[model samples]
Target: MIVSEQYGELRGRAFAIAYRMLGSVGEAEDVVQEAFLRMHQTLRGGEPIASPRAYVATLVTRLAIDQLRSARARRERYVGEWLPEPLVTGPTPAERAELADSLSLAFLVLLESLSPRQRAAFLLREVFDYPYREVAEFVGTDVDSARHLVARARTRLRDRRPRYHASREHREELARSFFAAAGQGDLRTLEALLAQDVALHADGGGKVPALGRPVTGRERVARTIAAGMTAMARFGVRLEPAEVNGEPGAMAYDARDRLVGVLGLGLADGRIRTIHSIANPDKLRHLGEVSDLGLRARAGERPGRET
Candidate 1:
């Protein structure tokens, strides 16, 4: 097939692979674009690619791996905590349901614990179903090394899997109950729905005064969320259900329809285990305007509540 046709077939898959590896949609898109650009240049210069699709995917993956190395250094210097950029595309309801677990904030956070090679190996193997040899080629590593990386990543991830294993329905239900309880200032309901060791971690990028430290204990998290909602109410901020990192979550918007913050929930055993509220101005760039969600809404929707 022609390079153009080959790119068309592989672009979406490549983008998906890069995005999962980097956890940054913008960066992933850039990596894919650059890969194609390189391919175009090579073809125009009369260099033959054995397989255009595979070549481009390999280019994108290598670029993403390098970028991840640099990003890790930058994140190490980041003020306070850092979180993945939430995917807020206006997807269909069905797409939202299908992508929720793959794009959940908690899942992405867990991925951060892996090294760049480990992440590339895991996503290529688990998400893309690339064989060990194919994954090794894409990542520019030997098959044995690739296998080891995937195994190590899996071991680390297995330890945390239980914390985020709730079904989509159960997670959404927990998110809804937590939000309603906070909105209504019902401390008892909040306490009942939250795990005793629940924690609240906010990433405001040091630009806003978020919880610089994790707020541990269910009562502490409840009080903190309640206080936050009360303060927002004082500032005329309204909370709405929104798709955050493919999971059921809330977003805070001002009277003018500008996104002010995002709320990400963590569930365990059908109870809220963690609440991540991101209000940093710098982090809101990708979120655009908060509007009526379709699949994205259902992706983050808490059931048992009136629209």
Candidate 2:
């Protein structure tokens, strides 16, 4: 029971670490659960293991690294642009702001560009605040190699991330306006709300058809959104606002309550700069369970309005 309680207490942070590493809730939860199982077995075996928390965390991190390595092949052959499965983060705590910021879809997308080892090394050293020595231990490298890995990762990530810091209320408000305008197929309003260099990326993962490449520029993105919203509406799909990854996002549901897709937006200078759509059924499996957005969407939404 003490072991179980310890596992429970550490589960949130464990899940957070794994999720940030792998960008998939189901995969992260699997890693966390496996770590707990291993820890429980080791404890029950009467083995002398010190610091259950640290041991379990390291175990989870290594497990997530393996998962990331294996997941890369599928991602390479992915139908469209691959995206991190949305985690549907709720209100951010001031104390956990660092963790919250690292979970953004845009940030996760940037992390995706790195190799599995570099990602693990960088995440451990940077986001999780582990020292270079510890990050080396986590990624199974020397301290110098770990430092090099983090530096390379950081250089690659620089300027690839959104200029974050907008209030959730502002993001949500903008999301509401964007969806309403897009739902109505109002190109003028859509263009006005979009940044000049806005980019829209859709991930369907070959299970379904989506934009194979990013649609960039305000005019192009506006055309894509307007056409997409209109086409979805014709197919009985409805778009409703839902908070995703601690930012304003939307949830799409068909008339029969099946989830169509999940979307997250990156706002810069109070305008939508990046739009991410995840329609891959494989990636979306956990959104039904982990996504608070799913319930409101399943409950029902009115047409052409914010939820």
Q: Top TM-score: which candidate number?
A: 2
Worst 10 residues of 2 by lDDT: 289-298
Evaluated at residue 135, the lDDT of candidate 1 is 90
Candidate 1: which pairs clash? 92-295, 93-295, 248-300
**Residue-pair clashes per candidate:** 3, 0
lDDT of 1 by residue, 122-195 (tens): 98887668899989999898999999999999999985743455766677778888889898899999999998
Off by over 4 Å in 1: 1-9, 89-98, 162-169, 289-307
* Local accuracy of candidate 2 as per-residue lDDT tens digits, 1-307: 3456776778977888899899888889899999989987987898877777677778888999899999999878876798988866665467335633687788898888899888888888777788887788767879999999989998998887655677767777888899988988889999999999999999877666578899999999999988888767765687777778867788887766667788898888889989999887777777663232333433454343333
Q: What lDDT score goes with residue 179 in model 1? A: 86
Scored by Cα lDDT, where does model 2 land?
A: 0.80
Best by lDDT: 2
Backbone clash total for model 1 is 3
